[model samples]
Target: MFVVPKPLRLLAALLIVGTTSANEPIKLYMPDAPPLTLHHYVGGHGMVGDVVLTALARIGKLTHIVAEPWPRAQIRVAKGKDMLIIPLSRTPERENIYTWIAPIMELERAFFSLDEPVTSFAQARQRYRRVGVGMGTAQVGILQREGFSNEQIVQLKLGENPAHLLSLGRIDAWFTGIPEALYIWEASAYREQNLRQSPSLASTGLYLACSRDCDAQLVEQLRNAINQLEHEGVSLLLRQAYLPLQPDP
Candidate 1:
């Protein structure tokens, strides 16, 4: 082996021992999108999905991507795997449960009714016949908080499939994020083709919550990277791209 200068040798040793601030590819979990997280037809992507992947790129991390249903993704993060869930709202229960780094995106929850108008959570709680909601979602918690019992709300695995039930008048209203409710409605091949989008009833911010058991250093690195990206204007660029496409009610 060739002899190396002392300074160069020291530099090489530091490079090997020092923690890099660069991004490392980590597994990410996202559920299918209809409204809240929609995949693009052109390249099989959605807004939240794009944000997760692109944010990793911004921080120079290798991105390992995965797509699964919401429940499964939740399970993965709960188990303390090397993963992150995106576009999730911040709630008290969640804070107690998971280690997350977000408010990644903002979302509004609302009702999509079949016959009568249900604007407020108060109205939905009192006048609704039957409501549909995604199981294990923040929307479900909201409806539960409004005093609707388990019997009144139909919990489905995915929010997109609820519109068919809504169209048949089997359910009175669908409780979901505005984007998802609209996605389901527009994708339906049934009645009420002229159904209109409703204004948001409640506004909540989404986040990239990770498991509490993950490496603290990794978590801080990501948080710092995301904050840096925000300061550097990457986050704003993304918002401008996706915000214009949101439904206007």
Candidate 2:
């Protein structure tokens, strides 16, 4: 029988006893949606992003949060890269593609206009030819579903202020989440434009979506922490931080 060297035997024992485990920090990615995730905001981190960080602290795992364009973030998560993308709208087509955590918020999808009220989508189309939408947003699909054609849609950069386009008359209307519209409108040069939100076209849930490579146990732990926040009413209080920004309806 061949005898193994003593140091090699000790190394083997160490490998067996001290192998790298699943407790390392995970990388997280977020898009540039304010009041949620961004490079800069009223808070150094974003609103929901801060909440997520606090929740992760509860679980005591190091997590790195990254900010990139929304499309790139989606692609990273979709390709099964190990990352968590936040405020993703859960859709039927995306249901089975990723792991989901607690919903961060619900976005009311509706139209914001610069001119007279557009009570209906058809009326809006007749009154305004160019409508602005955020690039690669769920609102893109929602608008398409509402029968707005390519010619009528102007795809704007993610996190860009569409109120500018409407104020400049480059685009007559904008379709976006109520919070985002309100946030941008509050700061736009045309804050006095009196941009009105049409009746909610729809409301959708924005959640934390994890890549397939993200460990199931870690995901469960994060989900549990989020659930605890919700149960203890901390989540709602965090959300209420932005409630003061909503325009009177």
Candidate 3:
């Protein structure tokens, strides 16, 4: 009996099935971090969001993006098949957790202090009793790596204001990206709040991360699209809209 190999049979089946499954919209998730992801205030999303949308549109096909609070969005993207979260900080702790795409942007990881002055991460680690940060953010891991104990890290729930926490003397400082912090402060009364920018922890590149189970071919395609966008300055142009002007809060 002549036996057909399993791989050949699968190829034949796919060829017969065609590209209907491939046409399904790719689902994307993002947090409410401004400049990177402006959750629900304007233009559907912010700079990075606009960049991704433009790239995907130019690439064609997949066309859906969703914004959720970090905690819920992170969990969804990390486990959901083929789902992705954008402007994700590509950290050592997260390096292997998901499949990474091109760097959407570089963000300065910073510590913001209120009432008292903390100059650097070392000073903040040694002097501050508690540091507040949005949950499911790279800042949380960065702070943990700075030797902050679990109790020393204050996780701000979605929709809760870290600046408010700092102003109320709840947390000693806040750890987040420079643009994100500034965006929040500029759009809210927090600009004049006691919070002040402290020393930067590090400059980190943020990317779009797909679940591990995602198709590798699609990942590569998306990466190429973003690379083209960045190379051609479309991404930079999209980013320019948010500069100086307070992005839709």
Candidate 4:
């Protein structure tokens, strides 16, 4: 029997590992959330997407982004193998469903109303007939946890503008991430109307997450890459470029 030298065996193992990593491309599911992840943005990917892409590049991992409705994107990623989802808010309800790789940014949810701002959930339930929130978003769960009834919560489908709904008096308040609310308000024709933002309802870290059974090695590599970006101030710079006036949380 012929025995391979230890150095030769180590070299062969390295070659095999490199080949596998280089060939396997991860699938990243993203929804169209402006200032975070969107197709029409200047870089063709928003702030969060850019951060994720930059991290993946640092790790030499190829990825293909799948643009889908928010609901479908979450479902597919939750069930699929080795799949990744971005800009996902980490909540107690979703804590066990996915492997949280890294926190991309902090998301502060609030109520944006054309009328008087609702500072508390109790006040909102008593005064507002309906509150608009994006379908399949963390805001929906947050409202539900706050004891908002079905009749009081209006789930806005993809492309449904809460600002427009507010103008038409469809929803009394829009419960959503502050960044998104500000972005929509600034761009919409409803700018003339005073958009009042209530105090933050909930705050959570948005993350790059993977399926429950994600590969541990991949998670470690991505996490390290993301940490390096954070250390170098790359993440902060990107965020500032998009949200210059956004207050630190």
- Give the alpha-carbon lDDT of every model: 0.63, 0.70, 0.70, 0.79
CA displacement after TM-score superposition, residue 249 of candidate 1 (Å): 6.0
**Which is the leading candidate under lDDT?**
4
Ranking by lDDT: 4, 3, 2, 1
lDDT of 4 at 26: 84
lDDT of 2 by residue, 80-187 (tens): 666777878898767887888778778787788765557777887677788898887888777787788898988898656687778878888888887777876886
Candidate 2: residue pairs that collide? none
Locate the minimum summed-lDDT window of 10 residues in model 2. 1-10
Task: Give the runs in model 1 whose Cα sits over 4 Å from its true position.
Answer: 1-25, 38-44, 190-192, 197-199, 236-249
- Model 1 alpha-carbon miss at residue 38, Å: 4.8
Go through the candidates in order and give the C-alpha RMSD of each one to the true structure: 9.5, 11.3, 10.5, 9.4
- C-alpha lDDT (0 to 100) for residue 37 of candidate 2: 58
Tell me the TM-score of each prediction against the true structure: 0.78, 0.84, 0.82, 0.87
Maximum-TM-score candidate: 4
Clash number by candidate, in order: 11, 0, 0, 0
Model 2 superposed RMSD (Cα): 11.3
lDDT string for model 4 (166-242, tens) is 99998998998888888778888988777888898789999999999899998998898888879877777656556
